[model samples]
Target: MSTQTSRLSPEKVWLGITPTLWWNDDFINIDIGIPFEQCISEMALAGYVGCSVGHKYPTDRKTLKAALDLRGLRVSEPWVSTYFTIAAMRKQTIQKVRQQLAFLQEMEGGSEDPRKADLVVAEFGHAVNPLPVALFPNCPNLTDGQWDQLLDGLHDIGRIAKEEGRRLCYHPHLGTGVMAAEAIDRLMENTETSLVHLLLDTGHLAAAGVDPLAVTKRYASRIKHIHLKDIRADVVARIHADGLSFESAIEAGIFTVPGDGSITTFPQILTELAEVGFAGWLVIEAEQAPAKANPLQYAKMARAYLRETLGW
Candidate 1:
């Protein structure tokens, strides 16, 4: 994952970490029994000053702020899953989004703050990521009708989020209906730019067999958030050939922190960001088992790599 690139200023490219490294919510057995305090403290010690909300964190503003502020960390974003393939889930999704937006807005404590976090969402429509291997190859692709439903719902939700003084960044995650490059193209082509934005994740893009920097160039204007991750490309290939579930692939160590993986395009991605004057959270999100890779050590390694490469 080594790359040689020019650096962006510290203020322009804020570094953050996702708590998935410390305590994975999807597969509890892999969490290594790390407490919330320990996780945040370790992140601070590892040189990260911001993070996205995870399952272990408090949802309430005051309690959450107190814990994070104590550790010199601020919230960057939060993931929200939306099942937009059906009509019934649409109302529930919006209601939930409104609640989330309200919480983030309240945290900002003003009409609009540049530091306010965007709401990151992934379409959880018939996602077969954690299911058995049989379901992985058979993962549902969005039908024309479903695409209509999704794009309309996204436009509505994204517009409303904007009206509420927040941004909505769509995350095209693996095992979802919109993981492929063609699907992402359709999404960007259909969705309103003023509302829906992109959350470009490096590892997910590579795992999906898509070139991450190409996506960055194609959708530079719409990218509102970034998730800098790395992939063991060989492991990813084997997972696809063997028909492994996302969970199984993760457990097999298919992902890792940047500078510890095979992603050589990392520097090019950073150069693209620098060229665009992009200024947002560069979240280090490597969803790997903590039992094998100590979260604190991995976090420190990533921090040191970024500092050396970006000269922050």
Candidate 2:
């Protein structure tokens, strides 16, 4: 009997990181005011080929393209906060999707590469991540009606994504409606596979008390993008014990780059992804205070660790 083998190749799976290393989207006080040029240049300096959009990224396509092309980096995906559960915000959410797709397409500059950028989306209708409230035992649960709204809105955006040659990858985020494993199950079971796919975030899953490897196994086919993050177990324990808010947890140094934290299932996760023939971006998205963690330093650390782990 003959069998085909699948592995993660440097050529196929690109390594990238979000600028969250330099700045925090949820808590701007964590930012160090790193200029856009330095932020992206350091990404390339760290041996990354791509990055997601950040708050500091210019909104102009030409300007953004010029800066990134200079560093040999490209945009991987951009996070979109979709208010699908809110009836009044639905139109605005779809508009945001369309705008982001247009921006992403223009960023490619009509490249012939078949790979399209992903839309990292999550429901933010009642998210507490931006608030000072506790994350656990505080995030609101979606009602049956809200679930229907969210799923229906996801399908709508998914179709839009397909039409635009992009993929809608739903990100199950902490302090959101779909943070829990059960909520993720509902999302996977209810959404149309063709329209909606998963953006697997390791840190978020781990922080929510869900096994990231189990999530990878169960939703292997549906997962189209990845956020390779690690978490500080000590900080997580404090959060649970003190009912710390999501923003507070982040400020308290709950998240870190892989190989720098307590999560030990990454090797198995990578092996499972390889076995499943997953070929895409593995983005290091450790949300930390830039001043304390040192963005470029941690970026280089993550790059070194990944090189060691993957033998690239």
Candidate 3:
């Protein structure tokens, strides 16, 4: 196993900002209104060392490299935010995973920009309500067959990533079937670490009622990337009371920037990452009400908080 260097210096933990922060229109959010090159330049101007390329953004190597070169920014990770039905065991779902792996492989090999050659992130385990009956009456959960399929699929993708000199980071998102701490443990245990890794999102962990800091300490060896977000517990309560869907709750402003919400344990989490020698990009990802706060301004504040409280 390749080990991360000991003690990531302050400079090593690159503070990155996703472009979605500034763009409000979901349709054009990933495709910034400005030219791709100009959009990247703006990100760099905002003091972000890197920008995560979402699947919605340009995935073509030529275009991606041009933008990175113009902005002097690195592609921290390719955020493949697709919903993979780990438990459905559907042929189409399995095919989508294959397609994603192929895309990642192409990006890894085609990009002349070395920074763009990092791992492709894949998320698993979301159980949206109005659930399918395969696992639940209205939600989707992994059946035994689906579980085996998911494991086999991940092993194949992991091997592909390793061959291409890339990595695959499995993201455990809240609202996903694998949201709980135990679920996360099971997912990790079932997969080969050499084939896939973890992308720990602190906000999701906390919102799911797990101690994010504890998970970080326990799985420090597997975490390759981190998404820094915070949530409001009151909002969470309201969502539960109203039986609001995750999408509806987000529309109602349940989530917020890392420091603007009730995630008081973040500083300790950051300290833990430091102790574990985790030197990677810390991306600020807020998918809340964009109109409530200016994204750029929010990012500025988030960066300031990270530096002040987290000693980043």
Candidate 4:
């Protein structure tokens, strides 16, 4: 990782990590699943104050909150897949957004100093990440008409989030329609900044051959949330050379905690965010095989790196 230090204050952002490291949500069959108690406990033990909800998280609000509170952890955000390109899925997608927002509201500490968890949305329609095809070749190219539907659908979704006291953070992901730098730029240029904010994922951008630092500098004003991780350049090269699927690349150990891999642009990216006075959740969200990557050990590695470099 780059050795550059950030000017961003530790208090400016809520540092969190996702439980996806402990339990693979996309490929549930890749089972190295640990108990829920151990997951959150290990996160807090590793010094994260918050986390995004995972598949293993309890459905009951009170139950989930209590478990997290015991370990000084809280929900940072939850991933909500949106099928905006497909007209039939639009209504249900909005409904799902409403339900997620309600869950976040219920998870809030109290009204005294209320901090609402933002919503993470991604275009999942025609997504190929979960399939068995090569991610690079299989990622769908959006038609002009599909683009219209997606942008319009996102506007409606963003409005609802704004009404509910939450910011909508759009996640540009691998094997999805909006995974590349150009797609991300188009989304940012067209969306209502107040309603739809960006959720910059360093690992995804780096793997897609885009510089994370450039994206951060370009969209810093609209970024409301972040997913921090590093990808092994060698692994990424192999994925492309071998025509690997997203799942296959992950299984091949393409992603890892920030400082544990070859992506050395994090410090520069974080510095850019700090310079822009960005304030929100910086989540450590790298999904890897638990058996191969050791979740707790990697979490600690990430925590130590953040402390050493960013003073988090």
Residue pairs in clash, model 1: none
- Tens digits of per-residue lDDT, candidate 3, 4-32, equal 22244545677777665655333342223
Give one clash count per candidate, in the order shown.
0, 0, 8, 0
Candidate 2 structure quality by residue, lDDT tens digits, 1-312: 012222677667888899999898767788878988899989999999889988888888899989988998888998899998876999999999999988887888789864457889999998888888878878879999999999999999999999988889999999999999999999999989999999999999999999999999899888889999999999999999999998889889999999999999888888878788888888999999887899999999999888877877
Superior candidate under TM-score, 1 versus 4: 4
- Superposed by TM-score, candidate 2 places the C-alpha of residue 297 at a distance from the truth, in angstroms, of 1.0
Model 4 scores a C-alpha lDDT of: 0.87
Q: RMSD of each candidate?
A: 2.2, 2.3, 5.1, 1.8
Candidate 3 Cα misplacement greater than 4 A, ranges: 1-7, 23-42, 55-60, 81-117, 120-126, 129-139, 310-312
For model 1, how does the per-residue alpha-carbon lDDT over 1-312 read when each residue is reduced to its tens digit?
Answer: 333245476766678899989877777767778889999999999999789888888877888888988888878887789988965898899888988887776666673435668889988978888576543486779899999999998999998889976789999888889899999999999988899999999999888888999999899778878888889988887786888888888888888999899888777788777777777778999898989889999999999988877877
Which segments of model 4 are wrong by more than 4 Å?
A: 1-6
- Candidate 4, residues 34-86, lDDT tens digits: the string is 98999999999999989998888899999998998899887889889999897
| TM-score of candidate 3 on Cα atoms, chains taken together | 0.79
Q: Which regions in candidate 1 have their CA more than 4 angstroms from the true location?
A: 1-7, 111-113, 134-136
The whole-model lDDT of each prediction reads 0.84, 0.89, 0.65, 0.87
Q: Looking at model 4, which ten-residue stretch has the lowest summed lDDT?
A: 1-10
- For model 4 the local lDDT of residue 269 reads 82
Error of 3 at 117 (Å): 4.8
